[model samples]
Target: MRFTFMCKKDMVPIAGPHGRGKIAIVGAGPAGLAASGYLVCQGYEVDVYDKLPLPGGLMSFAIPSFRISINSIIEGVEDLRDNFSVKFILNTKVFKRDTVRRDEGDEFTKNTVDLRELLNNYDAILIATGTWKSRKMNIPGEDSKGVYTALEYLFLLKSYELGYLNHEPPKANKVIVVGGGLSAIDAAEVMIHRGADEVYLVYRRTINEAPAGSFEINRLRRLGVKWMELAAPKRIIADATGNVKEVELIKMKLGEPDESGRPRPIPIEGSEFTIEADMVIEAVGEIATSPFPDQEYLGIKQDRRGRIIVNDELRTGNEKVFAAGDVVSGPSKVGRAIFLGLNAARNIHLYLTTKRISKGGT
Candidate 1:
C-alpha cells in the first residue's frame, strides 16, 4: 500500500491533557505505522513497540524486496521516526499481565514489556500485532533440518541481506516450496535467486484458485521455477542427518467449497508421489498472536481463530484498549491493513474527544 503523510497545515489539535495524552501501539506493521502517523498528526504522544530491530513488520523482514521495495517502507518509517514524534521502541515485545517467556528458535524477541504496565501508563492502547506464528503442516518429519515455514525461510534470507547474519543464505540445491499463496511464490523466487539448481512450487490447486492470484504464479512460471499443481505434501523424507531428502505428496481433487469460500482439496487415495529435494518450505499461512495470550488480564474478547474482537470503533471489550490490522481482521493485504489503521486512529480521536467534551472539556 502507498502510505501518505499528512501536510502540517492540515494538522488537528489533541483533545485533552495539553496534548500530552499518551497512546501505546503494539506491533510495527502497516497498521501500527499508519495509526502512528494519524495519532502523531493529531498531536497525541504515540509510542510504537515492535519485536524486530527494524520497523515495517513482515513487509520489511519476511516479504521479498522484489515484490515491494524496502526503500519505500524505510522512507515511510523514517518519516514517522524523524519528521514526526512517533517514538519507536524496537526489539521489544509486550506480553500479558505477566511476561511470557521467550520460546526456543524465536529470534525476533529480545526485550520484554509487560502489558499490564502499558495499560497503567498509557491513556489508550492499540494492539496491531500482525500474525507472527506460522501455521504448521503438522505432518511427519516436519522438524527436519532442511524444512522451514515460509516465514522462517524468508526471515533468514532477509536477515542475511540486512547484515544481521554473517552467514550466507541457507544452502539447499533443490528447494521444494509448498502452498499456492504469495508466500510460496516469494520463497521460490528467493531460492531461485540464491542459485538453487532447482526450485519447484507445489500447490493443491491451479493458479486460477491460488490465493496470490494467477499473475504471480504465471510470473514464477516464466522465471523457470517448476510449477506443479493438484498435489499436497503428505510428509517430509529426511536422511540420517535429519536433513530433507525428499517430500512425499498426494494428489488432490477439488471438492465442495469450505468455510473460506474456496474449493477444498480432497486427497485422492493411493495417489501418493514423492519429489527429491534438499530443502522444503511450507507457506500455508500465518496464525494470530495476541500480546495477551492468556486473555485473562484484559478480559478482551476474541474469535475462535484467536483474532481480537472489536466494535465499529475498533474498541475492544476493555474500552481503553483497541485492536487493529491483522490482529483484529486476520490475514489480509497491506492496503487493507493500512486502511484499518487509519480508521482506528480516527475513531480513537473521536472517542478521546467525546470523553473530554462530556466532562466540559475541549
Candidate 2:
C-alpha cells in the first residue's frame, strides 16, 4: 500500500535485503522517538513503551510550552504514527527487572510490562528512559509542604495548563527556585506567569557557571525575576499550617574547580540568613533510573552517578540490549539525545543484520 509522510524519503541504503525485524524500545522521549524514525526507515517494526499517556516524553509533558513548542512534538509524533508505523504503548511502563516497588512519576501509568520479558521477546532492546529521579537537597525540612522537585513541579504545572490534569497547581505569593538550570528557569517563569507576587532564583555559583547559562538568567531578570547568586538553601522552615514560611540560606564562596570544571561552592561560616518564602522548587537535576532493576545482579554496571555503562556503540554488557540518550550519556539537551538515539538505532540495525547474514551464509 502506498503511503504519504511529511518527512523526507528513505534513509541511506543499508546492507542485506531488508527483512522484517521486531524491536522494543523503552521510553518515548526524544531518544526513543528519533530511534523509531530511523529504525522504521530501515524497515523494522518498532514498539515503544512509556509510562505517560502519550509520546514526546519530557519535551511533551514536563517542559513549559513557552520554552518549547508542544505542537511541533505532536506533529512529529503523528508523523511517526501515520507514516513510520511506530507503535506506542502509552500509559504503560516497562517495569524494572527485579523490584518489588514500581517507579512512580507525575503521570499515571495504567499498564506494566516486565523488563525480562521484553529482553527475551524482542530481536533487540533499546533503553532510552531518561533520568526520571529528581535529586534533592539533603537539608532539614526538605520534605515539608510547598516543597517540590523541579521535575514534579514542572510536570504538574504543565499538565494542568495543558488541560490533561484538572487540578490547579499550588498557589504561592513568594516562590524560591533553587539551581540554575533550564528546569530552574522554567519553574521561576511559570510561577511569575501564574501570579506569584515574587519569584527568587537562588544559585550557589556565579551566572557564568550556571547550567542554564547567563542568557537565560538575563532573560529572567528582564521579567522582574530576582537573581540571588552565591547563596544556597540551607533549610526550609514551615509554619504551623505545615506550609513553607521561610527558607534559610548560606552564603557561598567560589573554591577550586569541581568535576564539571565549574568552581565549587563553599559555604561561609556564620554567614546564614532567612527569607520569607511560600514555595520552593529544587532543580538540582535528576539521576538515571535503570529499567533493569538490580542491574548489578544481572552483571550490568552503572557508574556512581547511576549512568549505564556502554561502549561506543551504546551497547551494554548484554549483547541483546543497548542504551541511548540521557540514560547512557547523562543529562543533556534534547537535540543531542535525538542524535544519540538515531546513532543507537543504526548500531542495533548493524547487530541484527550481521547476525541474520551469518546464520544464512550471506
Tens-digit lDDT string for candidate 2 (1-362): 01122134654434332358989999999888888878877788888999888688888778888877888888878777765667788988876534554343534777678877887778998889888888899999998899998888888776777777899778899999999998899889988898999899999999989999999999999998999999999999999989899999999999999998999999999999999999999999988867755545244566777777887778877777778988888878888998889888888999998862211100
Alpha carbon lDDT at 12, candidate 1:
43
- What's the TM-score of every candidate structure? 0.91, 0.91
Q: How close to the true structure is residue 142 of candidate 2, measured as C-alpha lDDT? A: 94
Q: What's model 2's lDDT at 303? A: 75
Which residue window of length 10 is worst by lDDT in model 1?
353-362
- The whole-model C-alpha lDDT of candidate 2 against the native structure comes to 0.82
Q: What lDDT score is found at residue 158 in candidate 1? A: 80
Give residue 77's lDDT in candidate 2 (0 to 100): 82
